[model samples]
Target: MAPTPDEQSRTRTLEGVLWMLGSGLSFVAVNGIVRHLGTELPAAQGAFIRFAFGVLFLLPMLVQLLRRGLPAGTLGLFGLRGAVHTAAVICWFYAMARIPVAEVTAIGYLNPVLVTLGAALFFGERLAFRRIAAILVALVGALIVLRPGLRDLAPGHLAQLGAAAFFAGSYLFARRLSDLAGAGAIVGMLSLSVTIGLLPFALLVWVPVGPVPLAWLALVAAFATLGHYCMTRAFASAPLAVTQPVTFLQLVWATLLGALVFSEGVDPFVLLGGAVIIGAISFITWRESVLRRQRSSAVIQNG
Candidate 1:
């Protein structure tokens, strides 16, 4: 007999959780590779090459997007996202080269918190008390990780924070564009725009990169693409609440990778901070899910 709707929903949620796991692993691998590359090349150059390779990988989609005319007035939005994302990418690369993988991963968690704030500020979303409390908790988590006075704040930490902010900006733009275009078009345009945006920075700090670095960057592009695809799959399969908590496992994986492979010391502060940030984000996601369900039920009841 065919599975019931409830059973099917459970199965899809499980599938989405698994997809989130895969997405986390793929991104962790990409981070490991970038860490391995170290400071062998300028961060701008590294970011540019990575996104440039990303463009090549996304060539077919780009071609398709070009063939199908873009939605009106979206060109500027894509360009803006690309510009913001380029900054994020560069800062991320710089931070990855210098910071412990776990720390970088932990700091990056601020993106969602910033995005929540951005939505309220820019999109007129209601900033409820719970959201305000969550945002404050997230800020505390970030402070725990940095411990500005206790430990000398490294440029890497600052860079990662900047990356998170810029990434949030990019996400906000993507959110706007999502209402106007398909995912494929948004992704393809973003990739193309980032490549173009990074061109001058990459050129400004051009250095001869060996073939090995080029190959590794190509692999980075592939894994990054895979991660995005898996994340998209996860979102399609289940609500964000089901998949969001699974991302905390990325900190665990990153910590293990750092300890085992990079021989980096495991910092308890980083782990604790990461947990706090993840918990806050998870709470927000859960609250949103509950609110959404309540709204739907009210609509059904009234109808």
Candidate 2:
């Protein structure tokens, strides 16, 4: 016999939490691998190999898509997203190689802030006062993370900031594509497009290293693939408000892994700044959820 409704809901909630945890852990693993390969390989080369391996891992899904037939339209938007994401990956990989893992992770939280700003500018999404406050708080957190006056700014930090903006654009385009394309199609197309876009740059900067770099590149691919899979599962099962908090666990995981695996020392400021950023993100997510619920309830009542 099938599970009761209560049991079904409980099962889904458990599964969603597990998926979010797995996603967090997988991304931490990816960061660890990137940090390990940081000085050993060129960032562009690492980015190329990572996406190349990601494409290979998604081959089965591509085959399945081929079997089902491709989506008829949206190739233009797909290409645009792929290009934006390609740039983001390059910048992100460079920052990973150049900066402390924890700092890069902390600065990455700016993407959500960018997303809110992007929505208002591009999609005409309303900018409520609470969201504006969250954005301001997040900006302060970013400044704390950067500490521009206290420490000399590095190119990697700027690269990471640029990458965050690119990622925000990618997310906006992705939301559009999601309506017309299946998940597999969107993912597969992204992998293929990014791989193609990165190839020339990878070739230009290519250095021949032996098997160690290859192994690290392979780990990057594996962890990222697993992270994306878990993220997809988590979103499918739960609201963003429920699953988003779990992602902040990545900062802790990154700090610990940086210390234990790479012998990188944790900065106290990074921890403090990351906490603020995470808190801001949690508030933004909660507010978005409340607004969504209110809108939905209004619709139901009106209908």
- Using TM-score, give the best candidate's number: 1
Following a full C-alpha superposition, what root-mean-square deviation does model 2 have from the true structure? Answer: 2.1
Every model: Cα RMSD to truth: 0.9, 2.1
Could you estimate the TM-score for every candidate?
0.98, 0.93
User: Cα deviation of 128 in candidate 2 (Å)?
Assistant: 0.6
**What TM-score, to 2 decimals, does candidate 2 have?**
0.93
**What are the runs in model 1 whose C-alpha is more than 4 Å off?**
none
> What lDDT does model 1 reach?
0.95
What's model 2's overall lDDT? Answer: 0.88
Worst 10 contiguous positions by lDDT, candidate 2: 36-45
- Best by lDDT, which number? 1
Candidate 1 residues 3-35, lDDT tens each? 999999999999999999999999999999999
